[model samples]
Target: MTAAITPTTREALARRIADLALAVPGRVRVAVDGPPPTAPVELAEAVAELLRAAGRPPLVADARDWLRPASVRLEYGRTDVDMFLDGWLDEGALRRELLGPAGADGSGRVLRRFHDAGRDRAFRDDYTTLAADAVVVLAGELLLGRGLPFDLRVHLRMSTAALGRRLPADLGWTLPAHERYETERSPGKEADLLVLSDHPERPAIRS
Candidate 1:
């Protein structure tokens, strides 16, 4: 079992992200990548809160919101591992609608959300301009190694056993895709920062 994370340690991680966000000259794009069970959403929220407290306007986005239509995602099958790894996310749309607008050289106008997974319909939201020093935090699985332009990339990693224990029985089929990600993408080594999240409550940074 992983050790419990102390309040101090959690605060430190938030501070580190805040510092990095502040260091960027203009708008910053940050990726909080991890498996679903690792609860990357929570981490992203925490980082956003810290950035906001530090006087930076922060926007949080979910990769799930950028998923392809169900028709496209289910082209192979509901449980197709390859599709889950590669086809589920609409990376092109994500780049065109959100990432590109939020990049350094691009305009800071961003769509807060798109593609509602539940209803499988497009989300029609107006674009909002971010402040010059604003920061965008996107949380999701398989975000790294996609050649996406993110100023800061933070990866949360879990052991195979831990992932297995945390994943629900229905999601068992996706295990192979995650294993492939580890072997092929090596996000833990490629990310700017790595957090060991075998136990959500007790996280450790890989130095």
Candidate 2:
């Protein structure tokens, strides 16, 4: 079992992310990737908070918000591995509505959210103009190896045992997809930063 992360360590991580946000002169995009049970969303929130406190406007985009419609996600059945691996997230929609606009080459205006998966409807067009030094944090599972433009990439990793222990029974079907990701994409090797997240309270930065 991993040791618990001290409060000091958590703060340090937040500061590190904040520094990365300010490293570039223009809009910066960051990705925090991990399985849902690993709670990468919490890390994104912490980073965003730190950036805002440091006088930078930060936007947090949740992958869940950009998920494809229920019909599309359920096409191969709710528990289909292929659906979880490839068909779940609407990568095209994300590129069009959020990533493209916030990218370095594109306009700095980003749509905070695009669709509501639960309601399976389009979200209201709430576009925000990012400052030249603003930061965007996108959090989700399997976010790496997708060729998305991100200035900083962080991957939270858990062992197979840890994942199985943390995952709910209903969501257990997605385990194989994650396993495939670990073997094929090797996010830990691809990420700019890798966090050993078997024990959420005691996460450690892996070399």
Candidate 3:
């Protein structure tokens, strides 16, 4: 017989996993509603270690899909079918090309395609397409654990202007909200508390 759906237990497990990620730097666990990335073996290993440290088994998960281009966007609270359709594609066709096998069902095909396509897009497009804010929030909740700070910094390494091009005017946002600007610039075109070092200089080497 199948086990009963235990959302509460799963949530608790999710929390524990996040906590482990916090304890173990350079890693984070995310629970999304669609298929996550399949490449980057290191990412998968890091996630697995986090779950193991939390006394749980790593399970399959999915991330959410963006409905449109960021240039013609809407707030998360708003629903625009036209924009959504623009981002939408035939999942079955996409999956057959990517996986070499038919997906389990229509839902699975769509999710797989979303994951596959998302990895190839620009940073802003990728974040919006995958609702990366949700991933950040979950990671923050896990890292901060309890008594989370009123404000948190989530770093994104790409450039804002480049990323913004993929978004619709209404859907795109400035630093802190969008991944492109979150790391390099804060509210005032200045550096935020968190800095992303794409290239780091060593003191000994420099001197």
- The lDDT for every candidate, in the order shown, is 0.86, 0.83, 0.28
Q: Write the per-residue lDDT of candidate 3 for residues 41-75, one digit (tens) a residue.
A: 22334545555565543322222222133433443
Candidate 3 vs. true structure, TM-score: 0.25
TM-scores of all predicted structures: 0.93, 0.92, 0.25
Off by over 4 Å in 3: 1-45, 57-180, 183-195, 200-207
Ranking of all predicted structures according to lDDT, beginning with the best and ending with the worst: 1, 2, 3
- RMSD of candidate 3 to the truth, in angstroms, is 16.5
Off by over 4 Å in 1: 1-8
* Count of clashes, each model: 1, 3, 10
Candidates ranked by TM-score, best first? 1, 2, 3
Candidate 2 runs further than 4 Å off: 1-8
Query: Which tens-of-lDDT digit does each residue in 1-207 have in candidate 1?
Result: 664433326657767777888888888999999898878878788888888988999999989999999999999889999999989988898798788889988888888788998999999888899888889999999998888889999888887888988988999888889889988989977888788888767678876
In model 1, residue pairs whose N, Cα or C atoms come closer than 3 Å (at least 3 residues apart or on different chains), thus clashing, are: 5-202
Deviation (Å) of 188 in candidate 1: 1.6
In terms of TM-score, the best-performing candidate is: 1
